[model samples]
Target chain A: MSAFYSVLKRELRSYFASPLAYIILVVFQVISARFFFLYLQGFLQFQLDPSYQLQTGDLNLNNLVILPYFGTISIVLLLIVPLITMRLIADEKKNYTAELLFTSPIHIRTIVLGKFAAALILLIMMLLLSSVNVFVLMVHGNPDLGAVLSGYTGLFLLGASFLSIGIFASSLTDNQLIAAVISFGVLLVLWLVGALSDAESSILGYLSVINHYEDFGKGIVDLKDVVYYVSLIFLGLFLTYSALESERWR
Target chain B: MVYVHNLTKRYGNLTAVENLSFQLERGDVLGFLGPNGAGKTTTMRIITGYMPPTKGTVHIEGVDIFDEPLQAKRVIGYLPENPPLYNDMTVMEYLSFVADIKKVGRKEKKSRIFYVMERCGIAEVRRRIIGHLSKGYRQRVGIAQALVNNPSVLILDEPTIGLDPRQIIEIRELIKSLSGDRTVILSTHILPEVTMICSKVIIINHGKIVLEESLQKLSEDMRSAESILLRTRQNGEGVVEKIHALGNVSSVKPGAAGEYIIVPRKGAEVREELSRLAVENDWGLLELRPVTNTLEEVFLKVISSEGN
Candidate 1:
C-alpha cells in the first residue's frame, strides 16, 4: 500500500510539474462550459413545455436545461480523460524510467494502480471544476440536486472507464501519440457499438459505453450499469498489469 | 557475497548470455570486461533481478534472485549504462523518489539521500533539474540512486563510459572508495579502469567467460613472459644478430631507427646477457627495458583467444 502511495504521489507530482494537468483542466472547462451555455441558449430559444419530459418525469424547466448540459459535459470529459492518461505508461517507457520502477521492490500492480489513481484524481479535479456549471444553474433557477449529483456520478464512472482504456493503450506502446490515438479509437468504438447494432442485440448494447451510461444519465442508479462500468475498469486494469509484466520478458 | 551458476539468457534464438558462471565475495571489486553486444548488460540485469534468466540461477547472499526477488534485490543496487532519470524532476526530488521505492525508512531517507549525494559529489547540484545538469552530474545522480539503499552489492554497467577525463578520475575514486564493504561488479571494456579499480576481472566474449582472474595475479603471470626493448647505436643487422645470439633470447626483431625488440624464452631474463653482448660488439646500449603488459594487452589477448 505504501508503495502504491509512493507511486501515486510521484505520478501526481509529475503531472503537475508539467503543462499536462493545466492543459487538461483548461480544455475540459472551456468545452464543458461552452456546451452548457449553448444548451441553456437552446432551452430559452425553444421555450419548450416545462412538464413534458421522459420516463422519470419530474419535469421542470431546470431538468430540461441541465440534462442536456450534463450530457455535453460527459462528451467533453470522454474526449479529455484519454489525453491525460495516454502518456502515463507510454512516456515512462519512452524515457526508460520504466526500468527503475520495474527493478524496484514494488509490485507491478502497485505501479499500475498508482498511475490509475493519479489519472482518476486529475479527472475528478476537472469534474469538480465543471460542477460550477451546476452551481450557476442553481443560482439562476431551481434545479434537482439529486439529478445533478447523478449526472456527476455518471461522469465520474465514464471518466474512470476512459482512463482505464487509456492506461491499457499506453502500455501497448512506447509512443504517447500512438497511445492517445489508439485509446481514443477504442473509446469511440465502444461508444458507437450500440449504433452499429440494434438494441435487440443484447451483447452489443452490453458492450456499448453509452448504453451503460444512459441509466446514470437519467438519474437512475441501476445496479447493472454500475457493475458494467466496474467490470470494464477492472478488465482494463488487468490488461495494463499484464502489459507491464510482459515488458520485463521483452 | 554473490554467486551466479550457469546463467543463460536467450531472446528468441539468439543467446545473450550462455553458461556464464562466477562468484563475488564480499569486498571484492569485480570488473566485467566485454566487447559491445557481449551480454555484459544482460548478465547484470539478470543478476539484479530486473530480468529472470532463461536458464540457471543467481544467488545473492544465498538467496536466489528469481525465487526471492525482493530479498535478493534488497541486497543489490544497479546502475544501468544509461542512468534512468526523470527529466522533469530535480536531483533531490529524483533521489527522494528512489528512496521511497527502495523502501528506505522515512526517518532515514533525508540523511541517506544527503550521504549519497555527498559521496557522489552531487550535493551542490541537488536542487538542479536532472535534465539541465551536465553528463557527469547526471552520472553521479545515477550512482547516488544506486547507492541510496546502502545495498551490500552494487552492479554498475560502464559507469564511466561518457565522462571527461577529470570526471572519469573522480568517478573511479568514488567507486574505489565504495569498495571494502560492498561487493561491486563494475562492467566496462575500458581496460585501464579495470586495472585501476578492480581487484578481480572477468573478461567475457561471444556470450561466455573467456578469462576470470585476479588483476594482480594475471599481470604477475604475464610479467614472467615479458619482452624487452633494446635500443642501440648499432645498425639493425648488428643489434638483431647480437641480441638473438644472447643466452635464453628466443627471437629479436629490428625496430624503428636501429632499435630492437627481443622476446626471451618463458621464465627467461636475457637483459644482462644482451647488455654484455652489446658491450662485446662495441654497440652502445641506448635503452634496455623489460616490457610489462598493460591491462590493454591482457584484454586484447583474452578477446583474441576467445575469437580463435
Candidate 2:
C-alpha cells in the first residue's frame, strides 16, 4: 500500500511539475464557466420564474437549469482526462523509465493502479472545480442536491473509465500523441454506441458510456449502471497492466 | 552468488541471446565485454529480472529470477543502457521514489539516499531537477537509484556510455570502489575498462560467450608470443641471422634505425640470449624491451575469432 502511495505521489508530482495539469484545469474551468453563463442567459431570456416548479414541463425548468451544466462538465472531462493520462505510460516507456519500475520489487498491478489513482485524483479535483457552477446555480435558485450528487458521481466514474482507457492506449505505444488520439477515438466510439443503437438492439447500448451516465444524470442510481462503469474501469486498467507486462517480453 | 544456465531470449524468430551461461561469485567484479547488439544488455536484463529469458533460468542467490522475481529482484540492482530517469524529478526525489519501489524501509530511506549520493558523488546535485543536470550527473543519479537499496548484486549495462572522458574515469573509479563488498556485473564495449577494473572478463560475441576467464589467466594464456625490440649500433653483420640461430629465437627482422625485432617461440623469453649476442658482436645495445599484448589486442583477437 505504501508502495502504491509512493508511486501515486510521484505521478502527481510529475503532473504538477509540468504545465499539463494546470492547463487542463484552466481550460476545463473556462469552458464550464462559459457554458454556465450561456445557460443562465437562455434561462433569463425565457423569463422562467425562479418559483416556477416543474411538475413536468416539455423541458423541465429544473432539468433545463442543471442538465446543461452536467453536459458541460461531462464534455470538458471527456477531453481533459485523456490528456492527463496520455503520458502516464507512454512517456515512461519513451524515457525508458518503465524498466526501473518493472525491475523494482513492486508488482506491475501496483504501478498501473498507482498511475490511474493519481490521474483520478486530478480528475476529481477538476470535477470539484466544475461543481462551482452547480453552487452558482444554487445561489440563483434551488438545485436538487441529490441530483447534483448523482451527476457528480456519474462524472467521476466516467472520468475514471476514460482515464483507464487512456492508460491502456498509452501502454500500447511510446508516442504520446498516438496514445491520445487512440484513447479519444475509443472513448468517442463508446460514447456514441447508444445513439447508434435502437431499443431493439439494447444489448449494444449497454456498452455505451452515455447509457450508464444517463441514469446518473437523471438522478437514478441503478446497481447495474454502477457495475457497468466499475467493470469498464477495471477492464481498461487490466489491459493496461497486461500491456505493460508484455513490454518486457518485447 | 549468481548463476545463469543456458539463458536464451528470443523475440519471435530473432534470438537476442542464445545458450548463454556464466556464474559470478560474491565480491567479484565481472566485466561483460561485447560489441553493440551482442546481447550484453539482454543478458543483464534477464539476470536482473526485468525480462525473463525465453529458454533458460537465472538464479540470484539461489532464487530463480522468473520463479520468484520479487525475491530475486530484491537481491539485484540494475542500471540499463540508458539510465531510467524521471526527468521532471529532482535527484533526491528520484532516489527516494526508487527506494520506495525497492521496498526500503521509510526509516532507512533517507540515509540510504544520502549514502548512495555520497558514493556516486552527486550529493551536491541532489536538489537539482534531473533534466537540468549534466549528462554525467544524470548518470550518477541513475547509479545512485540503482544502489539505493544496497542489493547483493549490481548489474550495470554500459554504465559509462556517452560520458566525457573525465566522467568515464570518475564512474569507473566509483564502480571499482564498489567491488569488495558486493558482486558487480558491468557490461561495456570499452575493453580497457575491463582490464582496469574487472577481476574476471566475459567477452561476448554474436550473442554467445566467446571467452570467460579470470583477468590474470586470460592475459597469461593469451600472452603475446615473446617479442623484443633490440636497438644496436652494429648495423647488419648478419645480426638478424645470428639472433635467429639462437635456440629460443624463432625469427629476427631488421627494424628502423639499425634496430632488429626478435621473435621468440611460445613461452620463450629470448631477451637475455639476444643481449649476449649483441654484446659479443661488440654492438652498442641501445634498447631491449619486451612487447606485451594489451587487453585491446586480446579482445580484438577473441572477437575476430568469433566472427570467423
Candidate 3:
C-alpha cells in the first residue's frame, strides 16, 4: 500500500511539474465551455422563435445545455486522455526508470494501478473544473439534477476506460507519440463499434463503451452500464500488467 | 550470501552469458571485471531479478531468485550502469519512495533514509531535484537510493564511470567505508579499482570467467621475477662477467640509457643478487628494478590463452 501511495504521489507531481497537464485543462475548459454556450444560445433562440418552438416545444434546458455539454466533453476526453497518459509508462521505459520500478519489491499490478489512478485523478479534476458550466445552468434555469449527476458519473467512467487504454498502449512502447496514436486508435474503435450493431441484443452494442455512456447523458444510471465500465477498466489494467510482465520476459 | 550456478542467457541466437558461476560470502566485496559486451550488465540484471536467465539459478541467502523474485528482490539493492532516478523528484522524496517500495516500515523509514543519505554524503542535497544536481551528486544520490532500504546485499554496476578523478576517489572511499558484514559486488572494466578496493576479483571475457582469484594472491602471482632492468656506473671491467655468473641471471643485454635488460631463471631473486654483485665489484649501482607486467598485458594474456 505504501509503495502504491508513493508511486501515485510521484506520478501526480510529475504531471503537475509539466505544462502539458495545465494545457490539457485549459483546452478542455475552452472546448466544453464553447459547446455549452452554443447550446444555451440555441435554446434561447428556440424560445424566441414561435414557429421553431411550435414545431418542437419539448426541448428542455437539461437536454439543451447540460446533457450535450457532458456528451461533447466525453468526446473531447477521447483526445485528452491519450495526451495525459502517453508518457506514463512509455517515458519511464525511455528514461530507464522502469528498471527501478521492476527491480523494486512492488508488484507489477501495483505499479500499473498507481500510474492509472494518478492519471484518472487528474482526469477527474479536469472534469470537475468544467462544472462551472453546470453551475451556470443552475443559476439561469431549472436543470435536472439527477441527469447532471449521472452524466458526471458516466463521464468519469468513460474517462477511466480511455485512461486504461492509454496505460496499456504506453506499456507497449518507449515512444510517447506511438502510445498516443495507438490509444487514440483504440478509443476511436470503441466509440464507433456501436454503429455496426443494428440490434439491441448484439454483443457489439454491449461492448461499445459509447453505448453505455449514452444512458448517463440521459440522466439514467443503470447498474449494468456502471458494471460495463468497471469491467472494461479492469480488463484494460490487466492487459497493461501483462504487457509489463511480458516486457520483462523479453 | 550470493550463489550463482551455470548461469546462461541467450537472446535468440546470441548468448550474452554462458555457464558462468561464482559465489560470495558475507562481507566479501567482489569485483566483477570484464570488458564491454562481456555480459556484466546482463548478469547483474538477472541476479537482481529484473530479468530471467535462459538457464541458471541465483540464490540470495537461501531463496531462489526466479522462483521467489519478490522475496529475493526484497534483499537486494541494485544500481544499474545508469542510475534509475525520477528527475522530477527531489533526493529526499526519491529516497523515501525507494524505501517505501523496498518495504521499509514507517517507523524505521525516516532514520533509514537519513542514515543512507549521511553515509552517501547526499544529505545536503536531499531537498534539491535530482535532475538539477551535479553528476557526482546524482551518482551519490543513486548510491543513497540503493542503500536506503537497508538491503542485505548491494549490487553496483560501473558505479564510478564518467566521474572526475576527484569524484572517483571520493566514491571509491565511500564504497570502501561501506564494507562490513554486508555483501557488496561492484563491477567495472577498469582494473585499478579492483586492485584498490576489491578483496576478490572475477575477470570475465567473452561471456566466460577467465580468472577468479583473491586480490592478494593475484598480486603476488603478478609480481614474479620474470624481467628486470639494471644500471650501473662501472660498465666495463668484470662487471658483465660477474653479473652473468650469478645463478639467478639467465641472460643480460645492454639496453638504452646504459641499462641492462636481464631475464631471470624460472624462479629467482635477481634484484638482491644483482645489487650485491654490483657492490662486490665496486660497480656503482645506479638503479635496480623489476619490470612487472601491466594489467592490460595480463588481460590480453589471459584472454588469448583461453582463446587458444
Candidate 4:
C-alpha cells in the first residue's frame, strides 16, 4: 500500500510539474463551457416556442441542457483522457525509470493502480471545474440536483474507463505518441460500436462503452452499468500487469 | 550474502548469460570485468531481481529470487549501465520515492535519505532538478538513490563509464567508503578499476567466466610468469639460436627494435648468464630489464587464450 502511494504521489507530481496538466484543464474547461452555453440557448428557445409546448414533457431542462452537455463532455473526454494517461507508464519506460520500479520491492499491480488513480484524480478535477455550468443552473434556476449528480457520476465512469484502457496502451510501448494513438484508436472503435449495432440488447451494443453511459446521463445509475465499467477497469489493469510481466522475460 | 548458480538467460536463439555461477560473502567487492555485450549487465540485472533467468536460481540471503522476488529485492540496490532516473524530479524527491519503495521505515526515512545524499556528495544539490544537473551530479543522484535503503548487496554496472577523471576518482572514493560491511559487485571492462576497488575479480568473455580469482592471487600469478627484455644496440645474428641453446632459457622471441624477449625456465636465474653471453657475442646490450605484466596483458592473455 505504501508503494502504491509513493508511485501515485510521484505520478501526480510529475503531471503538475509540466505545463501539460494546466493546459489540459484549461482546454477542457473552455470546450465544456462552450457546449453548455450552446445547449442553454437552444433550451431557452424551445421553451419560448409555441410549437414546442406540445412536447413540453420531453423538453425539460435535463433533456434540453444537462443531458446534452454531459454527452458532449463524454466525447471530449475520449480525446483528453488519453493525453492524461499516455505518459503514465510510457514515460517511465522511455526514461528507463521503469528499471528502478521493477527492481524495487513492489508488486506490478501497485504500480498500475497508482498510475490509474492519479489519472482518475485529475479527471475528477476536470469534472469539478466544468460543473460550474451546472452550479450556475442551481443558483439562478431550478435544476434537478439528483439528475445533475448522476450525470457527473456517468461522466466519471466514462472517463475512468478511458483512463484504464489508456494505461493499458501506455504499457504496450515506450513512445508516448504511439501510446496516445493506440488508446484513441481503441476508444474510437468502442464509441462507434454503439451506433454500429441496431439493437440495444445485441452483444456489440451492450459491449459499447458509451451505450452503458446513456442510462447515467438520464439520471439513472443502474447496477448493470456500474458492473460493466468496473469489469472494464479490471480487465484493463489485468492486461497491463500481464504486459509488464512479459517484458521482464524479454 | 549472494549466491548465483547455473544462471542462463536465452532470448530465443541468442544466449546472453550461459551456465554462470558465482557467490559472494559479506563485505566482498567482486569486480565483474567484460568487454561490451559480454553479458555483464545481463547478469547484474538477473541478480537484482529485475529479470528472471531461463535456467537456474539466485539466492539472496537464503531467499530464492524467483520464488520470493520482493524479499530478494529488498536487500539489493542496483545501478544499471544507464542510471534510471526521473529527469523532472528533484534529487530529494527521487531519493524519497526510492526510499519509500524500498520499504525504509518511516522513522529512518528522513535520516537515510540525508545520509545517502551526503554520502554520495549530492547534498548540495538535493533540491535541484535532476534534468538540469550535469552528468556527474546525475550519476551521483543515481548512486544516492541506490543507497537510500542501505541495501546489503549493491550492484553497480559501469558506474564511472562516462565521468571525467576527477569525477571518476570522486565516485571511486565514494564507492570505496561505502564498502564497509556491505557486499558490492562493481562491473566494468576497465582493468585498473578492478585493481583499485575490488578484492576479488571475475573476467567474463562470450557469456562465460574466463577467470575468477582473488586480487592477491591474480597479482601473484602475474608475477610468477617471469620474462626479461634484452635490447641491444648492435643487431647480432644467431642471437635467438644462442638464447634457445642456453639451458636456462625456455623460449626467445624477437621484440621491437631488435630487442629479444626471453622467458626463463622455472627456478632459473638467466639474467647473469644472458649478460655474459651478450659480452661474449659482442652485442652492445643497451637495456636489460624484467618485464612485469600489467592487468591488461593478463586480461588479454585470458581472453585470447580462451578463444583458442
Candidate 5:
C-alpha cells in the first residue's frame, strides 16, 4: 500500500506540475457552467408557457435540470478525459522513467493502479465542481434527493470507466497524441453504439457505455449497469497491467 | 553475493546475451568490459529483475530474481545506460520519490535522500529541475537514485560515459568510495576505467565472456611478454643481424630511420647485453627503452584474439 501511495503521489504531483491540470479544470468549469445556465433558462422558458404547463401534470427539476446537467458532464468528460489520461503511461515510456519504476521493488499493479487513481481523482473533482448546480437548485426549489444521489453515483461510475479506457489507450503507445486519438476513437464507438444498435434489448446497448449511463441520468439506479461499468473498469486495468508486463520483451 | 548461471536473452532470432555466467563476491568491484551491442544492458536488466531472461537464472544472495523479484530487487540498485529521471521534477522530489518506492523507512527518508545527494555531489542542485541541469548533474542524480535505498549490490552501466574529465574523475572517486560491503559491477569499454577501480575485470566480446581475471594476475601476465625499441645512429643490417643472433633476443626487425624493435624471449633481460654489443659494433644506440604493456594492449590482445 505504501508503494501504491508513492506512485499515486508522484503521479498527482506530475499532473499539477504541468499546466495541463489547470487547463483541464478551467475548461471543464466553463463548459459545465454554461450547460447548467442554458438548461435552467430552457426550464424557466417552459414554465412561462401556459399551453405546455396545462398539458403536463408537473415539472420535476431533477429531470429537467440536474439530469441533463449530468448528461453534459459525461459528454464533456468523454472529450477531455482523454487529454488528461494521454500522458499516464505514454509519458513515462517517452521520458524513460519506466526504467526507474520497473527496477523498483514495487509490482506493476501498483504502478497502474496509482495512475488510474490519479486520473479518477481529477474526474471526481470535475464532477464535484459541476455539482454546484445541485446546490443552486436546492436553494431555489425542491430536487429529489434520492435521484440526485444515484445520478452522481452513475456519473462517478461512468467517469471511472472512461479513465480506465483512457489509461489502457495510453499504455499502447508513447506518443500522447496517438494515445488521445485511440482513446477518443474507442470512446466514440462505445458512445455511438447506443444509436448504432437496432434494439434496446440487444448486446450493443449492453456494451455501449453511454447507454448504461442513461439510467443514472433518469435518477434510476440499475444493478446491471453498475455491474457493466465495474467489469469494464477491471477489464481495462487488467489489460494495462498485461501490456506493461509484456513490454519488456520488445 | 551475486551469481548468474547460463543467462540467455533472445529477441526473436537474435541473441543478446548468450549463456553468460559470472559471480561477484561481496566487496569485489567487477569491471564489465564490452563493445557496443554486446548485451551489457540486457544482462544488467535481467540481474536487476527489470526483465526476465529467456533461459537461465540469477540469484541475489540465494534468492532467484524471477521467483522472488521484489525481495531480490530490494537489495540491488541499478543505474541504466540512460539515467531514468523525470524532467518535470526537482532533484529532491525525484530522489524522495525513489526513496519512497525503494521502501526507505518513513523516519529515514529525509536523511537517506540527503545522504545520497551529498555522496553523489548533487546537494547543491537539490532544488533544481532535472531537465534544466547539465548532463553531469543528471548523471549524478541517476547515481544518487541508486544509492538512496542503500542496496547491497550496485549495477552501473557506463556511469561516466558522457561526463567531462573532471566529472568523470569525481564519479570514479565516488564509485571507489562506495566499494566496501557493497559489490559494484560497472560496464565500460574504456580500459583505464577497468584498471583504475575494478578489483577484477571481465572482458566480453560478441555477447560472450572472453576473459575474467583479477587485476593482480592480469598485471603479472602483462610483465611476461615485453617489447623494447632500439634505435641506432649507424644505419646497417649489422645492427639487426647482430641483435637477431644474440641469445636472449627472440626476434629483431628493421624499423623506420634505422630503428629496430627487439622482442626479448620470455623472461629474458637483453637490454644490457644489447648495449654491450652496440658499443662493440660501433652502433651508437640512441634509444633503448622497455615498452611496457598498458591496459590498452592487454584489452586489445584479449578482444582481438577472442573475437573469432
Candidate 6:
C-alpha cells in the first residue's frame, strides 16, 4: 500500500513539476468555459424569441445549458486527456526509469494502479475547474441540481475511460507523441462506433464509449451506463498490465 | 549469498544468455567482463528481477526470484547502464521517493537518504535538481538511490562508463569500500577495474561464460613465466638459435629492434642464463623483462577460444 502511494505521490509531483499540467488545466478551463457561454447565449436567445419559446413551452436551464455544455466538454476532453496521460509510462521507458520501478519491491499492478489513480485525480481536478461555469447557472438561474450532479458524474467516468486508454497506449511505446496519437485515435473511434448503427441494442452502440455517456447528460445515472464505463476502464488497465509484463519476456 | 543456475534467455530464435551458472558467497565481489553484445546486462537484469529469463532460476539469499520477485528484489539494488533518474526531481526528493518504494521505515528513510548521499559524496547537491547536475553527480545519485534501501546485493552495470578518470577512481574506491558485507556483481569494459575491485571474475562471450576464476589464481597463472622478452643493443644475429640451444629455453623468436622473445619450459627460470648468453656474445643487454599476461590478453584469449 505504501509502495502504491509512493508511486502515486511521485507521479502527481512529476505532473506539477512540469509546465504541461498547468498548461493543460488552463487550456481545458478556457476552452470549456468558452463553450459553456455559447450554450448560455443560445439558451438566452431561445428565452427572448417568442416563436422558439412557443415551440418548446418551457426552457429548462438544465436541458438548455448544462446538457449541451457537458456534451461539448466531453468532446474537448477526448482531445485533451491524451495530452495528460501520454507521458505517464512512456517517459519512464524513454528515460530508463521504468527499470527503477520494475526492479523495486513493488508489483506491476501496484505501479499501474498508482499511476491511474494519479491521472484520475488530475482529470477530476480538471472537471472541477470546468464545473465553475455550470455553478454560475446554478447561482443566477434555476438549473436542476440533480441533473447537474449526474452530468458531472458522467463526465468523470468518460474522462476516466479516456485516460485508461491513454495510459495503455503510453505503455505500448516510449515515445510520448506516438502514445498521444494512438490514444486519440482509439478514443475517436470508440466515440464514433455508435454512429454506425441506429439501434441502441446493436453491438456497435453498446461498444461506443460516448453512447453510454448520453444517459449522464440527461441526468440519468443508469447502472448499465456505469457498468459499461467501469468495464472499459478495467479492460484498458488490464491491457496495460499485460503490456508491461510481456515487455520482460521480449 | 547468490546462486544462478542454468540461466538462459531467448528472444525468438536469438539467445541473449545461454546455460550460464555461477555462485557467490556473502561478501564476494564478482567482476562481470565481456565485450559489446555479450549479454552481461541481460544477466544482470534477470538476477535483479527486472526481467524474467526464458529458462532459469535466480536465488538471492535463498529466495527464488522467479517465484517471489518482491521478496528477492527487496534485498537487491541495481544501477543499469543508463542511470534511471527523474530529471525534474531534486536529489533529496528522488532519494526519498526511492526509499518509499523500497519500503524503508518512515523514521529510517531520512537517515538512509542522508547516509547514501554522504557515502556517494552527493550530500552537497542533495537539493539540486537531478537534470541540472553534472553527469558525474547524476551517476553518484544513481548509486545513492540504489543504496537507499541498504540492499544486500548490489548489481552495477557499467557504473563508471561515462565518468572522468578521477571520478572513475573515486567511484571505484567507493565501490571497494562498499564491499565488505554486501555482495556486488559489477560489469565493466575496463579490465583494470576487475583487478582493482573484484575478488572473482567471470568473462562471458556470446551469451556464455568462457572463464571464471579467483583474481589471485588468475594472476598466479598469468605470472608463471610462460615467456620473457630479451632486448639487446646489436642486431643480434643467431640470438634466437643460441637462446633456444640453452636447453631450458624451448623456443626463441627474434623480434624487431634487436629483441628476442624466449619461451621457456614449464617452471623454468631462464633469466640468469639469458643474461650470461647475451654477455658472452657481447650483445649489450638493453632490457630483460618477464612478459606477464594482462587481464586484457586473457579476456581476448578466452573470448577468441570460445568463438572457435
Q: Fraction of native contacts in model 5?
A: 0.79
- Cα lDDT, model 2, residue A175: 94
lDDT of 2 by residue, A1-250 (tens): 2889999999999999999999989999998888888887777766666454543454543577677788878877777777998999999989999889889988999999999999999998898888887787778687678888898899899889999999999999999999999999999989888887788248878889888888798788899889999999999999998887877777
Q: What DockQ results for candidate 1?
A: 0.64
What's the best-to-worst order under lDDT?
6, 4, 5, 3, 2, 1
Please give, as one word, the docking class of candidate 5. Answer: medium
Highest DockQ, which number? 2
Estimate, for each residue in A1-250, the C-alpha lDDT of model 1 and write its tens digit.
2778888998999999999899888988998889788878776665554543342544454466777777787788668877888889998888878877877877889899999999999989988998898898788887778777887888899889999999999999999899999999999999988887776457987899988777676678888888889999999999999988876787
Candidate 1 per-residue lDDT, tens place, B6-38, comes to: 998999999999999999899999999889999
Clashes of each: 0, 0, 0, 0, 0, 0
Regions of candidate 3 where Cα sits further than 4 Å from its true position: A51-57, A196-204, B233-241, B250-254, B263-267, B279-284
Who wins the lDDT comparison? Answer: 6
Model 6 lDDT tens row, A1-250: 2999989999999999999899999999998899889999998898788777566534678888888889888999999999999999999999999999999999999999999999999999999999899888778998888888999999999999999999999999999999999999999999999999999899999999998988888878999999999999999999999999998888
Q: Point out the higher-scoring one by DockQ: 3 or 5.
A: 5
Candidate 6: pairs in clash = none
Candidate 4, residues A1-250: lDDT per residue as tens digits?
2999999999999999999999999999999999999999998887788988688466788888999999999989999988998999999899988889999999999999999999999999999999999999888788788888988988898899899999999999999999999999999998898898799999999989999998898889999999999898888889999999999988
All models: lDDT?
0.86, 0.87, 0.88, 0.90, 0.89, 0.92
Model 6 docking category: medium
Q: Which 10-residue window of candidate 6 chain B scores lowest in summed lDDT?
A: B234-243
Q: Which 10-residue window of candidate 3 chain A scores lowest in summed lDDT?
A: A50-59
Per-model DockQ? 0.64, 0.77, 0.73, 0.74, 0.74, 0.77
Instruction: Work out how many backbone clashes candidate 1 has.
Output: 0
Candidate 2 residue A166 C-alpha distance from true site, Å: 0.6
TM-score of chain B of each: 0.93, 0.93, 0.93, 0.87, 0.92, 0.94
Per-residue lDDT over A1-250 for candidate 5, one digit per residue giving the tens place of the 0 to 100 score? 2989878888899889999998999899999999999999998898888876575534668778888888888999899989989999999999878888998989999999999998888888888888887888999998888888989999899889988999999999999999999999998998998788779889887799988988887778999999999999999999999999998866
Pairs of residues at least 3 apart in sequence or in different chains that clash in candidate 4: none
